[model samples]
Target: MSAAFSFNRIVAIGLWVVGGGTALFLIAPILAIIPLSFNAEPFFTYPMPGLSLRWYNEFFSSEVWKLALRNSIIVAVFATLLSTVLGTLAAIGLSQSDCPARATLTAILISPMIVPVVVAAVGIYYAFAAVGLLNSLTGLVLAHTVLGAPFVVVTVTAALSGFDQNLMRAAASLGAGPVEAVLRVMLPLIAPGVASGALFAFVTSFDEVVVALFIAGSEERTLPRQMWSGVRETLSPTIAAVAALLIVFSTLFLATIQWLQGRAELQKTHREE
Candidate 1:
């Protein structure tokens, strides 16, 4: 028994080490850029002359950066809202056992995530161009909504796995209409999931570049698009500053998701009890 315990302990330790090392390897580049954003020398290099916020200042003060930031916020917000509504509704429908062609419908809904980004971008560009949506904010938001809705569907579906369908029946028995039952009963219980999905949608839209590249005009340039242009044209430290801010934003976003998941688990446990 002692020998078996020792082996299991060693295995656990080895797994932790491997996982931690892999995570570090993946994030090391992101970690490397954070310090460079603070570099006073105005160029990426080791052994910085000093630390300063000059790049951050430039990012905030530059009109180009300001416009990109505004566009990113607008697009992400609209995409998140639209995707959340559409995805939540789709998830609820898919969760119904009697739903027709469930697997095929699910695949169609999530194809945006499965398809190569460039392929999707090219398709969207051509499709939107036909509708005169090319180079428009509406086009960008709608395209991002497509990309982001799959995440919402997945998250909400997972949340519904723990949900009690009987509650909907109970609401109906209480003379509640379908829409009223969902709004008053189902949504509150699944709030964490819906919120989590919305956050994911926001992040998806905010970080998206390829679709934005195909759809956005100069006036609709997103932060990621601006960063791409900077890399190709100027290659300034302000890019690093923008990247560092994104890292911080992503960290906070992930933390929020974790908290939401934890809350969801707690609610599930209560329901089970």
Candidate 2:
């Protein structure tokens, strides 16, 4: 028993070490850029002369950056709204036990996630160009909606797995219509999943670049697109500042999702009890 316990402990320690190392490797670039964003000398180097917020000031004050930020917010918001509605509806439909061709439909819906971004971008560019949607905010939002909706579908579907279908029947027995049953009974129980999916959709649209590169023109340039241009053209510390801000934004967004998930789990446990 002692020998077995010692072996298991060593294995557990090794796994933790490996997991910690892998996480550090992934986050090292993010960790590096955050400090450099405040570099006073306007260069990417070690042993900085001093720390300053000039890059952040530049990012906020620059008209180009401001425009990029505005465009990103607009696109992400619209995309999130559309994707959430579409995805939640699709998930509900797919969750139905009698739904037809479920697997095939699911694959089609999630193909955006499976397909390579460049391939999807090229296809969208050509398709939208035919409809004169190229270089338009409408085009960007619609394209992002396509990419984001799958996340909503997946999250909502997972949420529905724990849902009691009999509640819908109970609502119907109380003279509720199909829509009312869903709105009053189903939606409340699944609210966390819906919100989680919306957040994912927002992040997906906000961070997307390749589709924007193909579909958006100068007027619709998003933050990620602007950062790409900066890397190619100027290579300034302002990009680092933008990146650092994005990191903070993403951290907060993820923390919210974590809290929501924990709340959902707690609710599930209470229900089970």
Candidate 3:
């Protein structure tokens, strides 16, 4: 029995080592771009050259980059608003419903993440062209909101799962109306989850390129569009700079989400105890 247990332990350790190594191998190339972004050389190659912040300064000072950043910010903010509102309402309504098809409804609501971006982009482009919204910011926002709504739904639904139906009923029994109760009680409780979801929605819209490529014209070009153009036009280190910035931004956004989730979990535990 001792021999068998020792063999099992060795196998488990070996498996863990293999998994960890594979993960690092996969991530190393992506992580390699961080240092490349800081290279003093104009090219993508690395050597004994010192690091510099010129690329970052260039990104901020360039008119092309500035315009793209502005457009990206606008789209992200608008998309986040729409996704949070729609996703929250959908979560609440689906949670309340006694229908047997609630699971199916939930699946349908979050299907955008599963569908290929290229396919979705093609469908939306034709659809938008028919409505005269192709190449417009509003059209891109609408497309991004639909794509991001699934993330919001998933996050908000996780929060809603822990919601107290009894509290809502009790509030209704008192002098509180539906809207009032929601504003005073439900919103406060779910605020953290909503915040996290909104952050994700913003990120989703900001980073999205495929749909933007289809729908947004020159006037509405976002940062990723500009990056894509840069890659096609030149193989400069400037593209690496932009990629590094995006990585840092994404890391910060995800950290915020984890923080909110931690806070929510602590609150839940306190209430339970």
- lDDT-wise, the better of 2 and 3 is 2
Candidate with better lDDT, 1 vs 3: 1
Ten residues in sequence with the least summed lDDT for candidate 1: 211-220
Q: What is the C-alpha lDDT of each candidate?
A: 0.96, 0.96, 0.90
Tens digits of per-residue lDDT, candidate 3, 46-76, equal: 6728898888889989998999999999999
Off by over 4 Å in 3: 1-20
TM-score of each: 0.96, 0.96, 0.91
If both were scored by TM-score, which would come out higher, candidate 1 or candidate 3? 1
Per-residue C-alpha lDDT of model 2 across residues 89-154, encoded as one tens digit per residue? 999999999999999999999999999999999999999999999999999999999999999999
Candidate 1, pairs of clashing residues? none
Report the C-alpha displacement of residue 199, candidate 2, in angstroms: 0.6
Task: Give residue 217's error in model 1 in angstroms.
Answer: 1.3
Per-residue lDDT tens digits for candidate 1, residues 1-273, read: 999999999999999999999999999998999999999987899999999999999999999999999999999999999999999999999999999999999999999989999999999999999999988899999999999999999999999999999999999999999999999999999999999999999999999999988888888999999999999999999999999999999999999999999999999999999
lDDT of 3: 0.90
> How well does candidate 3 score on lDDT at residue 103?
88
Q: Assess candidate 1 and give its TM-score to the true structure.
A: 0.96
